[model samples]
Target: MTLKSPISIYDAQGLAFGILMASLGVTFLKAAALVTGQTAGAAVLLSYLLPLDFGVFFVLISLPFFWLSWVRRSASFTLRTITAVVGISVVSPLLGAFIRFETLPPFLAAILAGACSGVGLIALFRHGASAGGLGILALIVEERTGFRTGWFQMCFDAVIFALALLVLPLDGVLYSCIGAMVLNAIIGWNFRVAQAMPAQQVG
Candidate 1:
């Protein structure tokens, strides 16, 4: 399906929903002591070891990618991605405070996080934004060559998970891999753009 050129008001709402879901997913992963990949994983890892906030780390990690977004993509795309990153960074901790999971099982947390991240990423992709880090790189690669962003992300995730083995328990690594796969699978299956259509027409 082809989306309109200029972003619609409905898509703006979708952007908000996508950010919210993605933030919630990150929060769940953090609570479960699991890490996915990319900026989110880095932020979670930092928040674990340092006296830093995940929101701050999330936004900080994403800052460097804006340069790539602006140079390879467009100002509008860069701005939108910045907005998405900021929104997720700010909202995640707020959600964490109130949405307490008293006894969230690791498996359940992994599934919930995966589903949220997958659906949220699809929404962001449809609206021409992403959560930054490998997301920005994936989007750019997908735009330049008709490659799938999800697969790109999965490759990056593999590296992240490999490093994660040093810090995370085997069970946590297993669940993280599962969540990562779920996230990329949703994008690969649903967020594909046709060869004839423009990359922006990805709704």
Candidate 2:
């Protein structure tokens, strides 16, 4: 996930951290110069290559998906997603001014990014909201086309990583994959928890 300033060239960590935070993921991929999957990943990758701020790119890339979400999903879903996206674009940049990482390794940063994102995303889900991106499209495809969501995500990740190779070092790509894996694992495990536990127990 990432957050950055539009007025400055800013740091890549903000872009990476921002993309994650917008989706409720924490920011660490940027510290390791890593990228991710989905719309956030694409935005992060673009921020690395372009002069635009991460938030600006995040909003631009999300516009089409927001339209799809409005057409395919409920209006409520789209509204909440818009709120979350705007919140991320605004709030994430402030995190850096408050919290600073003194020293973080690529492996550790990846892990933290996943863990924080997983937890944050769960909270968003509980509130009936989403960050929206490829995720919205993935869900639409899965429901309407009978495609598996997992497979869809995997394919997207594969593409993101492939492109990441051109921009990031091999180790950076590898670490980013690890972060993505951790995020998925946390999501999977928690979904099971959400399903199996009573609503009270889930809390």
Choose the strongest candidate by lDDT: 1
Cα lDDT of model 2 by residue, 74-124, tens digit: 565566567667666656556644666788898988887777765655444
Give the least accurate 10-residue stretch of model 2, judged by summed lDDT: 1-10
Instruction: List per-prediction Cα lDDT, in the order shown.
Output: 0.81, 0.64
Off by over 4 Å in 1: 1-8, 194-203
TM-score of 1: 0.90
How many clashes in each candidate? Answer: 0, 13
Q: Cα RMSD to native, each candidate?
A: 3.7, 9.4
lDDT score at residue 65, model 1, on the 0-100 scale: 94
